[model samples]
Target: MATCEADCDAAPVPLKIMPKDYVYSLLEDPQRILSPPTAVGETLGIRGSFEYFHYGCDGHQDAGWGCGYRTLQSAISWIIRRRDSSSVSVKDQHVPSIREIQQILVNIGDKGAGFEGSRDWIGTLEEFYVIDVLYQLPCRILHVKELGSAEALAQIRSYFEEYQGFIAVGGISDTASKAIIGYHCSAETGRVYLLIVDPHFASVPSCRQQLIDEGYVRWVPVDEFPAGTYNLCLILQP
Candidate 1:
């Protein structure tokens, strides 16, 4: 609903695949991990799987710190499209451009820490609440601290069961802040995966070209995600 004259140009460095050792380290507690789901959409009565969608890599002028914004764009666009569409056609749905998303962030007071865009970010949970209130969209934010991994997974599963859409997530990686879109889960296996649309890049144009050619959404196993606090934002009922 908002617009920006300037475009997001920040492109992330080429992504590095998560090493198996690192993933193993993160899952020191094997009890927290689950197997992958064997059931497909129809078999599970989920209607269908929601395919990955990117709101472009240069979200918020490709600012290095706008991962939160980019992540929000992906989740919000998916929810809106699903709410408005009569059929499952992710490709033909309307999605806000990068500039429009930036404008919405600004309108919701998400400008960075200093100088209006100085790499600061609105806290992930706070931003979810802002988006929920401003857009009149239903959102549920769950803190991992309050609900251990098992409980958290249960809550997230319930959300997807009801909404059948991806949610926004934030966590730590390489000791730095990161934001991503959580799109899939398997109750049978107790596993979840997310689309990591990293926002920090060395060359905006080149990185975006690479994403377009190879796809932007890189699925990462949640159990292997870095050690840090995580927030799950469930965009409810579209």
Candidate 2:
């Protein structure tokens, strides 16, 4: 595992283009609603990833419009660490910087008309651009329209069982999005909480540590998930 550093030292890895066989799977309320695992201090996350804040830049200042890139970068960094850690030392890992993220947006081809790369908007499809264009991994997009709390938790647990991690967007508000890199289940209350890397925060080098100190990843009730309508991006390796 790469040790946490002042710079979130996750070295960049060669972008692996996902094979054509790897495509996004859309599911609307999968019928499997099995009981979750014993909620005894269970938790999951990208081993060496850190929290990131999206702000400071002109167009990226708004939490609503900027969360798309922030959330996508969060997932990309996690995947990079998961893929590149084995070859580098704790100090040598390449963490994706804000500049890299903007470049990625530019490289994805179309940013839409009147697109100044700033104040532009993107949704689940744009999220796919980062996943499909920026990395080599098979991903599944779960279009959760009205999924029950129990069913959603079961599906999330099932995905973690099969993939490294997943990204969830929408459902919180009109435009709130975050990366679901980890989860925790409490045995005492039998409540399940997802450990997420929320992208809404003031831009600062201490953002990651601030999140950790604030217990941002604390277990949050799965049933109370904010998004009434959400998309779960199931990221997997080919």
Candidate 3:
């Protein structure tokens, strides 16, 4: 009864939609939500299912500094779902919240003190550490200084085909975080396309279609991508 009483007095953990609960969650399939408006090439996308996470989740105010965390949550959500596809129950496979992620870094010595409670931003490297420490999962990072690299694009397409999972992308000029769930290359015009699910949306629209109608979830050509060093975090599954 003492343990029960303590549990009752402790704060309640916010209920997060598990990977298997997409049926009950909002529309999150950005890749298939709306077809590309212009004529693009054949699209190759994630093999397994995943979810989209954005700002204001659990009532946390992380607008400017939480994009990477939200992107990481989406990417990690895919891995958890894939790993637990055969399992009977996935109630314990919780995606770490922003505060939990911050605390984990501090606890594991990955981040120094004063980082747990701060609203500091994180990048792809921090994402790698968090995924490694949390799930012991290995990740392949493609470090390139530009998005127009021919070899990098080839390898990224191959990654989607091989691993068939979501990729966390960072290093755009504005330093926003996004997920690359699908890729396309135009054979006629020799143009490159990417299906990006941005995590910087502060207010999730009341309707799922609004998210797509807006620029939050859409196809962007490589030429339109901001100029900066590009890094990709590819989570590999066994």
Which candidate's TM-score is highest? 3
As for candidate 2, its clashing pairs are 9-93, 10-93, 10-94, 10-95, 11-93, 11-94, 16-136, 44-182, 171-227, 172-227
How many steric overlaps are in each model, in order? 10, 10, 0
Tens-place lDDT per residue, model 2, 134-194, is 5545566676654336666677777676664656565535466666755557777767777
Question: By lDDT, who's the top model here?
Answer: 3
lDDT of each: 0.44, 0.52, 0.73
Q: Name the lDDT value of residue 127 in candidate 3.
A: 85
After superposition on all C-alphas, the RMSD of every candidate to the true structure, in Å, is 13.0, 12.0, 9.6
- lDDT of model 1 at position 32: 16
lDDT of model 2 at residue 26? 17
Q: For every model shown, what is its TM-score relative to the native structure?
A: 0.54, 0.65, 0.84
Please, what are the lDDT tens digits per residue for candidate 1 over residues 1-238? 1111222222322222121111111111111122223353211112222322222333235455555655555455555445645665433434444444444555545454232434455345644544454345556665564223666756655665576555566654442233343345655665566445543332333333354345343545667666656666666553
| Regions more than 4 Å wrong, model 3 | 1-26, 36-40, 88-91
Q: Tens digit of lDDT per residue, candidate 3, span 46-152?
A: 87666678887546889878999999888877877788566754546777788788876776676888998899988877787777766666778777777767777
Q: How much is the lDDT of residue 205 in candidate 3?
A: 57
In model 1, which runs have C-alpha deviations exceeding 4 angstroms? 1-63, 85-115, 146-148, 172-216
